[model samples]
Target: MTDSRPRGRRQAEAERNDRALLQAAREVLAADGAHASVAAIAARAGVGIGSLYRRYRTKDELFQRLSALSLDHWNAAAERGLAADDPWEGLAAFITACVEFGQGSLSPIAGAIEVTEKMRAKSDRGDELLDALVARAREAGALRPGVTAVDVSLLVEQLGTSPLLDQLRRQGRDDLLDEAAGARARLVAIAVDGLRAVHAEPPPGHAPTRRLYTERWRRRPEPAG
Candidate 1:
């Protein structure tokens, strides 16, 4: 006999399950650190271990899905920033979003609570999108000129790692985090201005000026907010 349950009911159930699992995973990772096991996650989800296994075959797979979900969230936030009519404003918004996302996230899933190489690679892989955005904005004269696609992409990730930046915000240090967020926003705007394609002629066919953009390479801390 065919069941007469509404499709809406099934979809809602699935969503609830996904949310439970995601939340459970976060709790397990946080409580146990990187050594958190699948059993722990299952218990946290209040689901049978088999159910957890059904959704995520391996720990790495589970994390990869979680990581992807996290990225999608931040990326969506970035897109929201891009919705501004002015390109400079859009870029600034995206940069702020990126910084805030990093400060708030990157602790769960990995258990180690740092941006992993895998996640960093995902961000690095967005070069084409960043390049296209920069090109269009520069051509539209939103940028001040002389800035390149590579410059904006690299800096967005680098400046976002400010240890002092995310921590203050997460620790309820709203004043300092607000202070840093504003400063970072301005930084993005300056870079955008520098990158805008200028109408003025260069000395000749001047090569793109590439210099020290990031002084700090080592990993820094911040709460993903």
Candidate 2:
């Protein structure tokens, strides 16, 4: 009977499917970049093509959504970090969340789809928070002499793409996952400590600039006609 499938049941199933699709899209897009196929995403999600099409008409659209979601996650983490009374604790906490959620791993899909104004706005907001967070740490002498917000951003991106973390997430090995987390935490602690002024030795090469960081997301200009 049509009534047997209640609206609540339908809604819950739809939500569940959406979560699966998002997870699959993240993995496939991160792995394959712009060339990732919709079929692969659907397969990874364990959903039919119909379900994928129902939500996203194209793989680009799926990647676009994921890109936007990544910004949202980062911004949320940044805001929470900004709120912490202790500057170093706030910065460390935010960095941990960003890496744990694979926030910067979505960069592989950058420029694959159009970057909308909304996404730009979100990125700008995140930049503001990043600047504030870095300033707070520097004022407290918690961050190194020349560390910039872009440096922290780049560091988070580098750590977010850990192969072991990705593999453990895929394998779902409960036993090893904790070990993986512990390893990640250790690495993060080391990275964060290196940022402190107490450990100051000028970082090799020039510090990353905001332009260099944002360039990754901007579409390259078309060749002059």
Candidate 3:
């Protein structure tokens, strides 16, 4: 006899399949960085490219999903880190987790970075969990007030894998394997301190120099003697 489930259950199973396919895409991207191919991802997911496209219209959509997955993992790690009792230790753990996650798990790209709105949306959907944690720390004097979660997010992006990480890894400098780990922790600490510092905000009406439009006169070549 064949076992049968309700029609609703069948739909749920299909949804699960779709999710699995997308997750497979994430795995492929992380392992190969930006070089992942749809065919390879489909094969890894035990599905066909057509099926994958049915779920994701193009590689761009797939990359968006990959960005979403990366942020989800990071947000979860942050939650666990913030749960620690010691504020400083919690912050340190958070930075370390960020380093660990970014090392080989994320492919840095200008395009992928543009998906930050998707990241913020996903994180916000979780009751602003990560943001709330940071806000709580700031409120408790553990972190500096006026330090938006956006600041922390941007800092992580700035300190993550340099072009050098891959270069060094390729060169067999195993010692540099976790060197950024400590530096990451210190960087986060400095950002927090700056936020907490009582330095006044720039005085009203004082604008930052706009070097974008200004050009320095080129030094004139010495007249041929």
The TM-score values for the models, in the order shown, are 0.47, 0.90, 0.50
Error of 1 at 213 (Å): 14
Q: Which whole-number lDDT from 0 to 100 does residue 71 have in model 1?
A: 65
lDDT of 1 by residue, 42-140 (tens): 877888888777777777677667776666755665566556687766666666666545523334333333445766665454444555566667667
lDDT of 1 at 64: 66
- The digit string of per-residue lDDT tens for model 2 on 1-23 reads 46578899999998899899999
lDDT per residue, candidate 3, 93-131, as tens digits? 665567556623444332333344666577465336556
For model 2, what is the C-alpha lDDT against the true structure?
0.85
List the global CA lDDT of all models.
0.59, 0.85, 0.60
Ranking by TM-score: 2, 3, 1
Q: lDDT of model 3 at residue 40? A: 84
List the lowest-lDDT window of 10 residues for candidate 2: 214-223
Candidate 3 to truth, TM: 0.50
Model 1 accuracy (lDDT, Cα): 0.59
Clashing pairs in 2: none
Off by over 4 Å in 3: 1-58, 103-121, 175-225
